[model samples]
Target: MHDRFDFLKNISPHHGEVLRNVLSKETRETLAAKLDVMPNGQTWYADIYQKAIYGPMVFRDPELNIIKTIEKLLPNYRILSDLYLEKTPDDQGFPFHTDFDSIGFMEHPEDMLTVWIPLTPVEEAGSGQLSIVMEEGAVRLSLIREANQLHSLVRVVDSSVPAHPPFQITQQEYDYLERTKVTPSLDAGDALLFCNAFFHKSEDVHNGKRSAYIMRLVRKDAKFNKTRLLALKKLGQNLAVVDELLKQHYPDAL
Candidate 1:
């Protein structure tokens, strides 16, 4: 297992301290309240089981400032979208999957990134810790075929899809993955910067609430398909507004 500090190296050194502060208790409490009231406060599940708040990047809230700071630090990356809090019980958690498999954020799959920031301290011994599979190892498994469609960050597939490949694992499988996959412990202020291709999931919440905020970033040069954007808009997902807002921010992209 790698230390949490190793993951920090992936983040821009300029924004590391700022991100740490952004994930603090005060910020989390403030942001959590805003997220709790979003219009689409549900999960869409096709292969996994989980609940979350999605598309927070576009919300009119103080949290956007923190996201902007990260964008400034990583000028090449755009904050595509985000999910607020992820909640589950001791025996329930998401399946192991890559963010790339979920939504085609860019023209090329590799151009996307995600930051998984835990709002609570997670120890190795704790059941609700976030688990990650090493990038090198996950490449060997079959890539997830269909991205679990998320209505908002808060919802997941209501039931597992049998035709889809298994993403969720049993407790035994989790243990086996730990033996082969690198797991890291995280605190409230820490975040994991991972490529969309990295396979990851969370351990079931055995005790306290395990909340995390996930922000998706994409390469600026990548294309955002208008068709998909329109579909999301028709669904009334607030992401359509976010897309327009970002376009206004970077007129060159439009």
Candidate 2:
């Protein structure tokens, strides 16, 4: 049961039109033009599971004006990473990867939250929902930097704590997570807000597609400058220097 105090909370019947309209005119062009390039030879629409457009492009649109709404919703916090549209196709494999991998750039990475708002109807046939390991907000994941072997963007988190047997996890811990894992049934306008350090993955869809507008937030003074981040995106750095870029460009990183 994810209570208000827990990291996972679902709000139903959210602003459906607003959520649907997040893919503004500019975002559509970004996808159609295929301009933005991701690290390690990944483009905006490279993979079926994750077709992400630069979030700033979507939110900056004058018609939507989403930043104001987000600021109102989460007081004392601002958008850490704008918004990215992730469309998980039918039966795609989006394995449990590092949830807070990007948070390391934040001055207070521990104090961060991820908001996932589904754009697809839950009642629709063959809808793939997101599955997450539910836990308390106070929990924080212990991770080690383990480079991906395949030079791919997706990688696993190496925990200092005895991870799952598959990766340092004991039977007891795995059992608890197994009991706590939740795949919430959310509507097109529903939002699932969760914290860092938990394992989350996408399910398989049969007939329909799963799309969500995902955003990260942190305290207003969390040392994130959206304009600067957009500029960094303009720099067009590859994935190899990503860690260095964050550590050097971003202040006070541990």
Candidate 3:
């Protein structure tokens, strides 16, 4: 809808308790059991990320209280069909970056927001949690005016395995983010909804693990360059720019 960049909305004590069971004891036991059989450097939560990112949660109960609440808060927007899981095992959190977006917000940042709900909660003093900078309105408006394209990542390597992630920004920009960021600690039934323009990341976990369900909600009326996007095979035009990021950061990836 071409709106101003709204900061994160702390939505908690939601109907998420109902959703938590989906990742049940059976799920944990099954995943833990697989560790002996898993390949090197793999954790169960990461394994879940790969398997669930685009595959699990094919359907949602439209009548669920949480779903209805999200729908109400996000008028004129529709949630994407695929809901996925995020697992932050001990000692791992993500580098700061905005969306690892598929639709690629392009010229409209306000038209999209990420809905992050923790199935299992974390204390405010917890070791591993999400930290973000809720930029002031003028800076936010200006930043997203470029469609939130100029964003940064921390904890990324110049060259190594799993190197050269996409949607990165300049080091100076990254420095500003590091100085200004604050952690958002969620309760068991809590959900954190943040705008597409904001840059966020996970801090390394030092204790118990974290698991959450994440999904994207986009305005139904947002513009799309369907023909050209289709030509790029869904990676879209932004990916070309990412190639430079790869060369600059993880030179070995190319």
Number of the predicted model whose TM-score against the real structure is largest = 1
Model 1: worst 10 consecutive residues (lDDT sum): 149-158
TM-score of each model, in listed order: 0.65, 0.58, 0.56
lDDT of 1 by residue, 1-254 (tens): 44334433442222112244446577776766776676545546311334455565642455546666666557887776777665556335656766643454344544566677777776665546666655333433413322333222112322342444435546775565566555567777577666565456667776657777777777777676444444444444555543684465544544
State the C-alpha lDDT per candidate.
0.55, 0.48, 0.47
Stretches of candidate 3 exceeding 4 Å from the true structure: 1-52, 62-66, 81-83, 89-91, 105-107, 125-127, 137-170, 231-254
Best by lDDT: 1
**lDDT score of model 2?**
0.48
- Give each model's clash number: 13, 6, 1
Report the C-alpha lDDT of model 2 over 1-254, residue by residue, as the tens digit: 24333223331112111223333455444433332353212443336445554333345445555578677666676664544444544435555544533334343344566767666655443577766654542123222221221111121222243433233445665566556666767766556665544566666777645656676666666564332233333444222333344555653532
Better of 2 and 3 by lDDT: 2
RMSD after CA superposition, every candidate: 7.6, 8.4, 11.0
Cα misplacement distance, residue 129 of candidate 3 (Å): 1.9
Worst 10 residues of 2 by lDDT: 146-155
RMSD of 3: 11.0
lDDT against true structure, model 1:
0.55
